[model samples]
Every structure is written in structure tokens, then in C-alpha cells.
Target: MPNNNQVLFVKTPSASSIKGNMFLYERKNEKQSWKLADSFPVTVGRSGLAKDAHSVIPLNDNLPVKQEGDGKSPSGIFKLWKVFSYHNLQNLKMPFVQVDTNFYCVDDVNSRYYNQLILADTAIKDFNSFEHMKLSSNGYEYGVWVLYNSNPAIAGNGSCIFLHVWRDENTPTSGCTAMAKENMLKLIHWLDEKKNPVLLQVVEE
Candidate 1:
């Protein structure tokens, strides 16, 4: 399948790549080739890549796959579900959710809220654990939710995959893609709802 018109192509050179950084490229239309969007350096998981989608390459002893807390960035084509920020100052054409401490992405495999974003005060109180999404925090100052397993969560697959701000060029995330704040802002502003923007993350040969 082809990437949607607006594609964020993140390319990693190899599987055992110790350096988690990758190049981010963007393109406006499908008719045109992708262009280097910016110097938006992104940090992936320390363990490298995992097959997260249906089209992902088959796994072997040599290749890693995704499970809960694998610390490997999911490889596949996915959509940008929504923009979430810890700050209310986001200026964009799309609507963004101003997240608070109560906001959580449930990771409990047996809970009813698995792989779903729910409020902490909700009746679903019993869960193994969840990420306390805070935008004001250093790790999540600004972020956009990446639609990974949203349709129907397969327990123990993966959760809380997002595109957010990184501390610096040298930091690596648990299983998310992070970049410079300015570059994140540029991506936020450039993403249009009409174009159906999507993220295509692949491991390079």
C-alpha cells in the first residue's frame, strides 16, 4: 500500500543500530517526491524496530517484534489520530486535547480500557498501570498521538506510542518518536485534517 499524501517517513539504517536517531521527511502531495522537512532529529526505542502493523515484514530470530514495553519503535504505516499538548498555547489548524495528570493511556492487558485513553477518575479503576500523560512535563511538553492499536487493542501488544518533544539530540525514548520542540511545532502546524496525514516508519537495509 502507498502512504497517504502527507507522509512522515522515519528511516532507520539497521536493526541492531545502537543509535536510535532517524531522519524525518515530509511531502505535501502524493504526486510529488518527499523532501527533507527539517533537522527534526528523532529518538526511537533503544532496542530498535518492531513489526506493529499488518504489513510489517515477517519476524525471525534475527529481527525483533513488538510486545508490551519492548522499547522498540513500531514499524509500519500508521495515522496521526490527534494532537495532545501539556500546554494550552498550541496554535494549529486542528483541534488538540490539553492533557492533564488524570489523562492516562491504559496499558493493562486484562482491563476494559486496554490501549485506550481514559480518565483516572473513571469507573475503570482496576488496571495494571497506565501512563500519566502530562504535557507540562519535560518528556511530554508537546505531543501528537500516533494511532497504533486504537481500533481494537490486542492485550500485550503495545500502547502509548506518540510523537512528542525530546530533551535533546542524544536522548532515546522507550517506544516513541521525539524531536526538537520547534520541529514538532512545525509538524503540528503543517498537518492538515483533509490530507489524512500518516506516519511511515521503516527499517533501512
Candidate 2:
């Protein structure tokens, strides 16, 4: 029989592999769906969530509008925003991971975005410093947002959201997801205007 090709694939984060980042791959057969592209690893949160769209947040800049209690990386669908690596930042590597710290969550309930954008200034005093630059765990500074209500509302309930390089021995992340250096690069490359690339983070139920 001729080899059959499938459309999509699925990957479930487990207790053993949650710390190890995962890669998406096309299915090899009809019976079997998507498989891990390789044996890479990911850095899961200490809380250990489960496989639910309500717990995955897209790093894009469209949907899942940020909310007051909405934690960063709130579970939901979002798109991959632009690239802001420390290698590309103002040329600095003070920290370790090459992350972006420019993004902010719109925490104002009265505003249109509410908790969405690294939004504009507000009358609130805390809002004033919202524009100030923040550093990533890796010391890099960048920003990313997403569409409204794409993933679940449980993505970043643990607090803080990010997609950066995974630590050696695959340490657990504070609440963000992480991967290897090479994988991080690959993710950046795969992301673009099309395909609407997104990161699906799931915890162990």
C-alpha cells in the first residue's frame, strides 16, 4: 500500500516530558496522528497544569485580550508576535535568557483593552510606570500580545508568561514554557504572518 499522509498531529505534555520542550510534526500515517518532531525538551511550570486549550496562551498580538485577573500567558489562542532576542536587543546580555521585557498587560478594567496591551498610559499611578522597561529572566527586553479569548483562562494563573530557552537539566519554569536554544531559534524561524504559529502549554492534570 502507498504511504499515507495526514493533516495534523497532537502532543500531550506529561510529567516526565513537561520540563522538556516539545516540537510539532506531521503525522506519518492515517491511523497514527502527529508525533514529536524530535526528542527535545521543555520547561513547564512548577504548578503542573493539564492538557486544555484553557491553559495554553498564544504569544501573538491579536486575541485573548489581557484582563485584570488574567494572568500572563493566560490559557487561550494567540499568535506569535515579532522577534526580540537579546542578540537583537540594544546589544546587551546582562541576564542569561534572550527574552523580551517590553510587552505589558493592559490591567485597567475601565480601558477598552482592560488587561490586553502593554497599553497606553492611564490616570493610575502604577499605570505610569507601565511604560518603563522591564527585563526578562534572561535579561532581554521585548513584548508580545494575543487575540481575544483564544485559549483558556488558566494559562498563566501561576503568574508570569514567557517562551524562552529552557535551563540545563530542564528546570521547571516559574509559570512560562521554555525550550532548548536551538529549539527556540527554530520556533522563531517557523513563526510569521502565515500559519498563525502559537505555543500550546499544558500541565499535568
Candidate 3:
């Protein structure tokens, strides 16, 4: 049902594997086959994959379901939201925001801003836990927001999911997809807003 023509597909060996492969595909239209644009080695959550609200595939009931603090990545089709970077890059094809100290992603389930990105100084400070969008490490230096649990943002399903730079192939994220910095920058430059890009995470068939 998704009308997207551009897709970033991620495939893991199983629901528990931290290692995965990411492929970028694009099509001229709904009737056209998706052409492979690029591929890269990637890593997923430490705890692995889980069914999410946006999941479109038939999933086994025994599979784990995503939850807050579960250290699992959501498995499903998700719209690629805005791109966030430590520096303001030019000529990007997707909507972008420059991250600073004021930016925070609220994760407190009880707060009204739960599962939403907000400016620390402008929003109500009711949340006790959050991730600073601008981190000391380069993991978040350049990234794309993965729109999971965001449409209606269920209290504790998950939050702050993104496609970011991984520490290394051996390092798994808390609950996001990660790859090489160069690949991430390649993705950032390649994504076209008009193409309606989406992210698809799935266990390999």
C-alpha cells in the first residue's frame, strides 16, 4: 500500500542477528521494478528485530514485539523522515535539520512529548529521560530519521530510530540501523524528497 518509489531495504539473517545488509533501490514508477542503486554492510540493534506498528509483512506470532528499552530495531516499512546532521550540509535532496545542544529526543513514556523530537528550551520539560541529538561521538554526526512509532506514537513502543553511522561492524546499536559514515553520507546525498523514500527492515527469507 505504500506509494514510495525509493526504498532502503535492510535484511538480517534472523530476528536475533545484529549484522545485516542494506540496499538502496529506486524505481521510475509503481509499475517499474526497483533498480539497485547501492549496497552496504550494516548492523542492527543489539537485541535484534521485532514487529512494529508499521509492519506490513506476515509475521510469526512467536516473534518478539518491539518495546521501549528493548534494544531491538523495529521490523517494518517506514517513511524516511528528515535528515539530521551535526553540520549544515549543502545540496541535500531531503529535508534536513542541523542538530545542536538544544535538540533532544524524548523517551520518557509518561511525558506528553514521549517518542517525539523536541527543542529542550521550547518544550515542556516533563520528561526525565532523552537522547541529546547532538552527541559527543560521531555516530549521530549524520543520520536519517526512521519514522517508527511516530504516526500515533504509542507510549512505549519505541523512539528515536534512525539510520546512522555505526561505531564499527562489530558494534550494535541500542535500537537503530547503522553503517559506515561514508555510506551514510552517500545515502544522504542520494535520497530525493520527491521520490518518497522509505525504510524496510526484515528478517531474510
Tens digit of per-residue lDDT, candidate 2, span 90-119:
322122223334445433334333334342
Off by over 4 Å in 2: 1-18, 26-39, 50-78, 87-103, 106-160, 202-205
- lDDT of every predicted structure (CA atoms): 0.75, 0.41, 0.91
Model 3 residue pairs with clashes: none
Winning candidate number (TM-score)? 3
The number of the candidate with the highest lDDT is 3
Ranking by TM-score: 3, 1, 2
Encode model 1's per-residue lDDT on 1-205: one tens digit a residue.
3546667878677764534443445566667787865545577877777877454434334556678888887888788887888778555756588888889988788888887888888755879788888845567777889888777778888888998888777777788888888888888887776667778787776
Alpha-carbon shift of residue 123 in model 1 (angstroms)? 4.0
Give the per-residue lDDT digits (tens) of candidate 3, residues 1-205. 3578899999999999999999999998899888999999999999989888557777656678899999999998888889999998999989999999999999999999987889999998899999999999999999999989987899989998999999999999999999999999999999999999999888885
lDDT score of residue 100 within candidate 2: 33
lDDT score of model 2?
Answer: 0.41
Q: Which ten residues in a row have the lowest lDDT in candidate 1?
A: 53-62
Error of 2 at 155 (Å): 12
- Residue 183 accuracy (lDDT) in model 1: 80
List per-candidate RMSD values in Å: 2.6, 9.1, 1.1
